[model samples]
Structures are given as structure tokens and as C-alpha cells.
Target chain A: MMIEESFVNGNSLIHRLNPVLKIGFAIIYSFVVAVSSKFPSLFAALFIALFLVILARLNPRKAAVRLAAVNGIIILFWFFLPFTFQGEALFHIGPFAVTRPGVIFAAGITLKANAILIAFIALVATMRVTTLGHALNSMLIPEKLVQFFLLTYRYLFVIQTEYQKLTRAVKVRGFRPGTNLHTYRTYAYLAGMLFVRASVRGERVYQAMLCRGFKGKFYSLHEYSISKADITCAVFMTAAIVILVVLEWTKII
Target chain B: MDKDNLIINLTDISFSYPEGAPLLNNLSMQFYKGDRVGLIGPNGGGKTTLFHIIMGLLKPYSGKIEIFGKPVREEKDFRSVRQRIGLLFQDSDDQLFSPTVLEDVAFGPLNLGKSVDEAKVIARKNLDSLGLSGFEDRITYKLSGGEKRMVSLATVLAMEPEILLLDEPSAGLDENTRASLIKVLTGLDLSYILISHEMEFLDSTTTSVYIMKDGKVFMNGDRQIHRHYHIHPHSALPHRHESGFGKKYTDFLA
Candidate 1:
């Protein structure tokens, strides 16, 4: 199964932004929005995030699809939060009272969550994962952790391919999955075999690395330099985040 | 060949897996500077294991490995040996770990202490030599089987090693790709020990053939292993004896 990195490829300005700065912007923007409780700042954050999505040229329908997955868990909050929190009753749903504070709290959470997610999708997700690894490494993340991240990203596809091969072999031999002990055991065996193959492949990969003189350090061919666009992006993101903070703290909507 | 021309010498090599039977038993082999050798063996005959030992990926229980006329024992000793000797793995997936083709090809050159631009230049040159001029930005995992094999070769070639050890370079390749592989292999100026089962491929590419079986290598000389045949009336498909041994081999309906 191919990984669908739909937002990574584009010719938009956001796509051209430096990945290191983009990661930094995403983290700060998300953190700021996460701590704000007022509605004006949250709505502003949502608007900024939407602006970023527009700048990224991402398809609106696709963005909504991604947002829907995140909101699936948030919808559970809507179910219980409106009826349980202590506040002025907004309305009566049969025997339960819907509190005003509960409704407001849930709405604030929804806005904050989506604003952060959308901005992150626009900023961090626009670059390839390998580039992200380099960016993270340049940000002073541990070399081992960056290496682990990059290697995991590279091998996830291989492991998935291995999985499909095993699934095909089992399917060709009249093996049908069902709620039975035989099916469970077959799946268990399949998992076991996949692990065995993966471990063996891992050994061979390490050997191949050593053959090429891999001495505990991975060098990247990518050279990242700050451009005019990166500087503009950094300035814009900082200003937007500062405005959000001021609107929340100083109540200057 | 003179002792001065020896590229790799493995003397008294004996290796076996833990809790398993022996594989290579006192196997002695010598590779010279200007030799294209083909190593053929049955499955589980320790062909891949031998390649690993020569590159110091695996340690032999009892052996003396001499590369470039110098004895190599410890891991540090093998580091220099690995730089001069490249090994193409049996599976291209196992060989390529980078996200893109260019990065993967440049990996060996970069490891060899080349600058980024230098490594990229070498990578592009090798890729162009292999007729893969525009595959630099292509995702490694998304490549076709034949393309992946060629790219894997490009990765090995980018290092500019003195010798290459290719493990089943043509396995699972189509006719056109296999033909291209044969052309590339024959065009190389450096020496290589090609491990393959295809007699036609081995016949066209190697100057000599060695049969490895039962933990020992027997010299097969520069003989014509590729033969033409037709489907027998008694059989359903045209097939030749891959091993070219045993009593049933005479049933090819010549």
C-alpha cells in the first residue's frame, strides 16, 4: 500500500517555505492556540489556519476529509460535555440539562483542535518526510532519533509490501479469515512469519550499509538554505501567533 | 596469476551457523585483478554467506581474509576492505534504504568521504552510464523490479570500487532488462564475482566459472555452459537441467 502524502507535492508558496521554519511555526502556532480559552482568539486561529490551507492550495474537499477523521473523536466530546458540566442550563434534552459552559467549552476545544491541525497540515505536511527528518536534525534533535525516524519511514513501505505478499500467499491456498480458532492461528502464524522475514531483511540491510562504509552517521544529500520566502513566512507566522496571544490575554479582539 | 595481482584471497575459510550444520568448510579461493568469475551453487550452499565474509559482514570461524594483499582480521581492518569492494545484495529492496533514487545512489559515495556535490555528480554519471539518466527524483520503493535492479547497480557503481560482488543481479528480471544487465556487466572494466543460476547470463558475462557445492568450489573452466534445445515430445515444457549434473540430466532430448 502506497502512503498517501497528498499535501507534500505542490508549487504553492507554502510548499516552498523552509521545512525547519515551517516545523517551528507549526509547533508555536499549535501551542498558542491550545492554551487560549476565549472565543475570539480561537476563531482567529481557525481563520489563520484556513488562510494557510488556502495558501497551500490544498483541495477543500480533501481537507474536509482529513478534518472529519479528527473530528470523529471530538464529536464524542459534544455528546457528553453539553450535559455534564456545571453551569447555567441552556436547554432540556428530555431529563438532562444542557449547560451553557459545557457547550462553550466543547466549541472552544473543537476550534482549537482543528485550527492547530489545519495549520500543521499546511506547514509540516507540505514537505517530504525525509526532508522533515533533516530539518529536525538541523533543529538539534538527537542524531539517533532522527535516524530512527527516517529509517522507520523508509521501511514502513517495505514491511507493508511484505505484509501484502504474505496475505496473497495465504489467500491463494484457500485460507479464509473468519471468527474461528483456525483463522486466528493462521493470522498469528502470518504475523510471526512477517516478523521473521523483516528481522532477516533488517540484518541484510545493515550489512549493505556497512558495505558502503556506513559508520554510525547518515549524511543527507539535501541542502536546505533559507530563502526570501522563508523569511517572509517566518515573519508572517510570528506576527499571527503574537496577535492571537494578545487577543486572548488583552481581550483586544 | 602472480601473487602481486591477487585482489582477494580467502584461505582455510570455515563457517557455520549457530545450532546448524556447517556451510563453508575450509573453502579457499583467490580472486585476481583482471578476472570476471561466476560462482554457481545450489540453494543453501553458502554463496551469499561467502560474499558476506569477504566484506566482513560476517566473521568466519577459521579463515584468513586478505584483501589488496593485506591480511584483514578485525572490524576496523575490514572497513578499508569494504570501501574497495562493493557487494550488490540478492534483493534490491534490501540494498536500497533511501527515499529517492539519487540519494540512494549517492549514499556509497558520501560514505566514502566525498562532498555532497561530488557524490551527486558521481551518482548522476553512474546512473547515466546505466541508462537511468532521469531517475534521480523517483521514489525508491515505487520503481519497477527491473528499474530497481538497475538503480541498485548504479548505487554500487557510484562508489567506484575496485571489485564488485553481485548476488543474483538478474534474478526476476524481464528479457529486455536482463539483456541490458548483461551489456552493462560485460562493459565494466573492473573485476566482479557474479553469483547467478542462469547459464546463458554466466556464459556471456564471465571469463571463468566455478561450481560451489557441498562447501567446496570446483573449477569449471571457461566452458560453454549455454546450450540450445527444443521442447521434448515426452515433456510439456522446454527445460534444461539447471545443475547440469546427476543421472537424470541426460533426459534433455538432445
Candidate 2:
């Protein structure tokens, strides 16, 4: 599965932190990482994020795989950003110029992306997505957004399977993609069919939910309580945020 | 409970879709205590629609529905009624909506305001009863059709409903799984209204048979009836009586 439900169940400290607190930390940490231009502070933020990945007991290979896709985007920035900007020319191909400022901007974006990606892979990947909706609701995020997340999470896999089945059916009929109007029209029809099916499925699912006594409000079966562990984790996260902010502002690495 | 007491009484029930043809026309029926009624019909015969009406998912245009002597009208009224009466959808995919089998089974109890731990216990008990003890953690979509059907049943049974409306429980099962389902369903003590096209499966599980045809229902007098006595599945639930209606309806065969 290219898109994975990647909650690595574990008993590590990062895994046990309150989801609300972890989300808050990720947001603030990403913001700090984004604002920093200094290499030392950016590297320090990356190290902290990596440390959390270790604390969460995530498999290194799996984390690397997740990062690999993001790193591809980062590599694209290097290709274009370093050669496009007009600045101090650091080097040259026969006709093109590689500017120092362009290289610096590209490197900074790469650092910010890596730091934020690692932080999210550690903090968010430890949560089962259904409960993440509950946590988002408890954080006083808009009810509609939470509901949207929940409904999307519930049906995305079903829709993916639907699309896969359609593709297989097309393949079985010897429909190969070429630079032709037939292939494009076929794809358009497939998309239309999927949309129609999804709409019908949505109505049926809504009716089923009503039959089960859904009263326009979703109640999470898990009650939210602030335990001592959660409290301690909150303190730890606050300390981590302070350290990150200090590094960003002070440039002390 | 009195043996002859009517559990569900519908009088002159008439229903139709908006701008569509009428499905139920002046259909009146009475389900007595312990009536294991089987509803058999062809497609578009309104069997599933009737099930929805009983579950309060659809409203009849003109009728009075009394369940345990209480009238049902709005959504709130049905909320209380649904707790005591479970409906198994024809599509197991629709019924088992939760991501995992365990979560789906526990959904009803959790909705009833039970704590997670208590709901887990009820879910496990139901799963164990259905011979699905270790299947709890399996992904809902990854399950086989038979396993999905069993898990759906477990979800309903977890609610400890007094009455069950099962729609086409054996529609897509193989012989072995269908027989296993038959055994589990037949072993249950509570009354259920089972809708199926399979006459042999219905004959094996249901005490009485009704045919839905021409926008009405009629009791089948041709099939011989067999008496079945069952012990209460749970002590906390009330005992079920062998419906007196079933006996009188069977007399039509004689």
C-alpha cells in the first residue's frame, strides 16, 4: 500500500504521550524549523526529530521508506533552485550558472522538509487514526473538519479498492494507456463511474449508521483523561519545544 | 412474558417511496412472544423494506406500530427501540463498518454508553459464542464473506437485543459456513424475524414461515412446523416463550 495506516503500536514514551500534546509539539516544532536559516539550528532540530523516532520505537527501514518520498521532492528543489536564481555564481555548467544564494535557499528548504517530515513520522504515526479524530475534536478544532477527517478515513480505503478494481477490469479488456483520445476517454469514464459508486455507497453507509442509532453526534468510545503519564509527557514535550525555540532564536545549535 | 402476548403489532401499514410505487399495502401482522418468523419473498417484494419499517429506518404512510405495546414515530422513539431490537443488514459490508472486527462488535455496547472495558468484554463474549474467539483483531475488510457475516452477527448479538431482524443471512455463504450459521442462529433463544429466499435454510431455523407477495403477507400453511425449545443465552436477559401464534398457524397445515 503506497498510503499506509502506519501506527506502530508500542509502549515507548513518544507512543504514550497525549495525542493533543504531540500534535501541538509537531506544529510548534515545524514552525520553528521553518523559521530557522542557520544550518546548526536546522541540524539540531533534525537530530531532535530523529531522537523522537528512536523513542517511538519505530523501525528504521520503515521510517526511511516514508522519508524517501519526501526526499524526492527535496531533491527537485536542489535541481531547480540552485540554477535558477540570479546571485553569486558558485559554479557553472557550460552555459548555466549555479548561484550561492540559490544553493543556500535550496539547502534550507531541504533541511526544513526533513526536520518536519521526521517529526511528523514520529509523533503522528504512533496514533491510530480513528482516535486522532477524537483528539482533534477535543482540541477544539472545528467539528466539521473533524467529521471530514473521520469520514475520509473511514471510506478512503474502500474508494481505493474500488479504483483498483476498475483499473483491473480495464486491463483485462486490453485497454492500455497510450497518447490517444481513447485512453483518456476511458479514464474519464472510469473516474465518473467511481464517483457515482462512491455517492451510492455514502448514502447506504449513512442509512446504516442511522439504523444503529447515530444521533448526529459521534461519541468516541475512549474517554479522555489526563493521567500522570500524560502529564509527564506534556512536560517533556514543553521542554523539547523550549529547546528547539532557543536553538532557532539563539542560533546556538 | 405471557406465551400468547403480541410483541410487535402492526395495523394497516401502508408504505411507498416518493414518486415510486407502493411496496406495502394494508399489511397488518402480529408477532407473538418467541415467534421465530421467517420471511421469504422474491426481489422487489418489500421484505427488506418491511424490515426497515420495523427497525424505524423507514416510516409507513399510514399505520400504527406497537412494539412491546409502545408506539414508535420519530427518531428519538426509535433510538430507545433500537437498543432492544437489532437489525442485521443484507450486506455484511454495510453492517460491519468499523475498521476491525473487535471494534465493530463492540460498537453497539459502546453506543449504549458502556465503558470501553465493559464493551470489550461483551464483544469478546459474543465473538466466543459465535466460534470466532481469535478473529477479533482481524481487519474488517480483509475478512472472508462468511467471517464478515459472523462478525456482523456478533455485533448485533453483543447488543443483547430481545428481537432480531435478520435480512438474508445466508445469501452468499458456502454450504459449510451456511450450516455453521444455521447452527448458531438456531441455538439462540431470543426471537428473530429472518428474511431469506432459501426455503431449506429457513425450514431448518425458523418455527413459522410467511410469504411476502403482491404487496401483502400470508402465512404458509403447507410446510409442517417443528417445536423448538431453547434455554436463555444470557441470564440477565428475559426468557423467551414458544409463541402461541406459531402453534395456531401450524394448525392451518393440519
DockQ of each: 0.83, 0.28
Model 2, runs deviating above 4 Å: A6-13, A16-21, A142-144, A170-174, A177-182, A223-236, A251-253, B1-4, B115-118, B134-138, B223-254
**For residues B77-167, what per-residue lDDT tens digits would candidate 1 score against the true structure?**
9999888898999999998999899999999999989999999999999999999999999989889999999999999988888899999
- The model with the greatest lDDT is 1
Q: Give the Cα error of residue A92 in candidate 1, in Å.
A: 1.8
lDDT of 2: 0.82
Q: Write the per-residue lDDT of candidate 2 for residues A1-253, one digit (tens) a residue.
A: 4246665577888877788888888888888888888887888888989998988889899889989999988888888899999999998988999999999999889888988999999998888776677788888798779877877776787888899999999999998999999999999999999999899788777666766666665555555677798888778778877876786677453
**Worst ten-residue run, lDDT, model 1 chain B?**
B245-254
TM-score for chain B in model 1:
0.89
Error of 2 at B249 (Å): 21
**Model 2, position B249: C-alpha lDDT score:** 41
Among incorrect, acceptable, medium and high, the docking class of model 2 is acceptable
